[model samples]
Target: MNLQAVLAINAIGIGIIVFVLSLLRRQRLHIGYGALWIGASVLGMLVVSAPPVFRLVTRVIPTSLPFQAVVVMALSFIFIVLIYFSVQLSALLRRVTDIAQHIGISELEAKSQAPERNPVEVEKRGE
Candidate 1:
């Protein structure tokens, strides 16, 4: 990789790290999400700082170019993150369903315990 490209990558990695840290400080991002961003930024920085390591990775992979290897790695990372978020969403959905069912059951129980009121009697009392 060229010096300019390496510097640009480092700059981007540092920017991401700073942005993640600010979000964490402001409590805008949860720790689990922040950690993933931080890890990605660190990995980017490491790869940018060590061109030889990237070259080695490209050699190990079937990619003809370093850029292709990087792209593949990025896509793989995104896929894994997507799977993680999907699992989290599924759990949240399950919990919400359980809560709604519980509320429905509680409402039924409460209604059964309360005495039924006659509309005619209620209207006469109001008059």
Candidate 2:
């Protein structure tokens, strides 16, 4: 009935969809770390949005603290998830470059191994 409840329920639904789709596709998800992000997002939404849960906490924890803590915690979760993927992306890019370089070097080595084809000797013979 309330806005928060709506949001939380929607978030849970969306998370489940994403998880199912990604898993079914055998998706090589962004650096192989999407599960934690989805889990955190779903759990955080559910915890924050539920009225009864907050009602209980408001008794001991300062009234304002719950809101403040939730905001901070949600932000932290988002930032952490972003950073994890960013690091993974960077690592993947580095590996791609390293592989490319390795392939280039192998190609060069292969070129050099051709029979009867030393550039310097060929030059001298030509003269």
Return the TM-score for candidate 1, rounded to 2 decimals: 0.79
> lDDT at 21 for candidate 1?
96
Tens digits of per-residue lDDT, candidate 1, 10-96, equal: 898889899999999999999989999899978976875786877777787668667677678778889999999999999999999
Please list all clashing residue pairs in model 1, or write none if there are none: none
Task: List where candidate 2 sits over 4 angstroms from the true fold.
Answer: 1-32, 49-65, 114-127
> For residues 72-126, what per-residue lDDT tens digits would candidate 2 score against the true structure?
6666777987897799889999999999999988998798765557779989899
Residue 94, model 1: lDDT of: 100
- lDDT at position 71, candidate 2: 57
Instruction: Give the top-scoring candidate (TM-score).
Output: 1
Global Cα lDDT for candidate 2: 0.68
